[model samples]
Target: MIIHFYNILYAFYENKDIINKVNIGGIIVKNYIIIFAIEAGLTIIYALFSGLNLLNFLNGTFTVSMIGLCIGLFMMMYSDGAYSIMGHSFRKFNYMMAPKRIKETMDEDPDFNKKLRIRQEKYIWTNPILFVSLGLVIISLIAMYSMV
Candidate 1:
């Protein structure tokens, strides 16, 4: 079950079309909000169900939440860089695969080229959902750590 869940998460991260559809600027803003929500939700769950000192757990939760936030931030930054490269490669592949002059000409225009680059950049760099999911995973790991 855990492995399956992890695989699903990985699949989501690997999905290029979904990443491309999302706006990078929106992603950056959404990520912070989502991460905060995930942290709060996890903290609440741990407090209610886990066998731990409420106050101590709260402290640990906050600490873990910060760590998760940092990890999420790092992932977002890394993915942004990686996506830029990957998206560029994909766009090149698409250009190559395009049929004939009409298709080729559309991709050749300077304005179109510029827009494509910008869109690809945005797609590659931003993923609010992934960050939120990662935050939850991190929080879960922290809870387990505290238990141990």
Candidate 2:
């Protein structure tokens, strides 16, 4: 059973697209690291405002964050290859997972302009989202300090 499981996972790991994405840090690593860093920073900031002295807060946050980070990373790694866990190659999984409607639409439409427009629309909200997150972080920090 263990050998079979290893073989299945190995197949997914060896897939060209999966290997390329994993190696280039495109599919998950970079984005997941940024997300985890933001969450960990917020956790530390919240801990700091919990009334513990700096040293205690630092120590507590470090301990808690390390454990939480390990667990979080493990879960992310496990989920990154959903198909591998179910005994399917990543390439096959991705092909199967793609939306049929989107594929058909793209196939029927040869215009590159529509695709470019969709891509641009996706990026339009990035600035607003970042600003909102920054505002929320600042407000939380101020509120936490006010409590002290």
Candidate 3:
């Protein structure tokens, strides 16, 4: 019975259309907060393992800002990479999994997939807002460090 339930769950995720829709819905929900938590945990572990006084580290404005900068950059990198790989993978999966009519139309117009692919690929590299925000954070971190 347990094996049967697992198979049913696996089958649902294995369906490309369902998975793509789910991924689309998750774009907003799946974001930097999750990465920040993971990075924070790692940062805490590093601080502890390195024999740093946690209170002193946390009390330093520069140290706190630098940690935030690191987490933000790491999240940006992760989000960009995932977007790049998943966008391409989604297109391929769509081509393979689309219904008969859609697949026929897609085949009739070779450029259809290509055009959609270019748009999706553009997001991975052309996020000005993310870059500007990260830049501001880094600048603030540097300013704080200089003041210290």
- TM-score of each predicted structure versus truth: 0.35, 0.26, 0.30
Taking the tens digit of each residue's C-alpha lDDT, what string does model 3 give over 68-134?
A: 5565565566655665566778887988889999888988985665433322223432233343345
lDDT of each: 0.58, 0.48, 0.51
Note the residue pairs that clash in candidate 3. Answer: none
Q: What stretches of model 1 exceed 4 Å from their correct place? A: 1-45, 49-75, 78-80, 114-148
Superposed model 2: Cα runs more than 4 Å off: 1-33, 80-148
Worst window of 10 by summed lDDT in candidate 2: 112-121
Q: Which RMSD values do the candidates have, in order? A: 16.6, 17.3, 16.6
Ranking by lDDT: 1, 3, 2
Residue 73 CA displacement from its true place in model 1, Å: 4.7
lDDT of 1 by residue, 42-80 (tens): 677767676567565655566556666566566666655
| Tens digits of per-residue lDDT for model 2, 5-88 | 564467577773432244221233344455546655766776677765654454444454455545554454454554344443
Q: Give the TM-score (vs. native) of candidate 1.
A: 0.35
Higher-ranked by lDDT: 1 or 3: 1
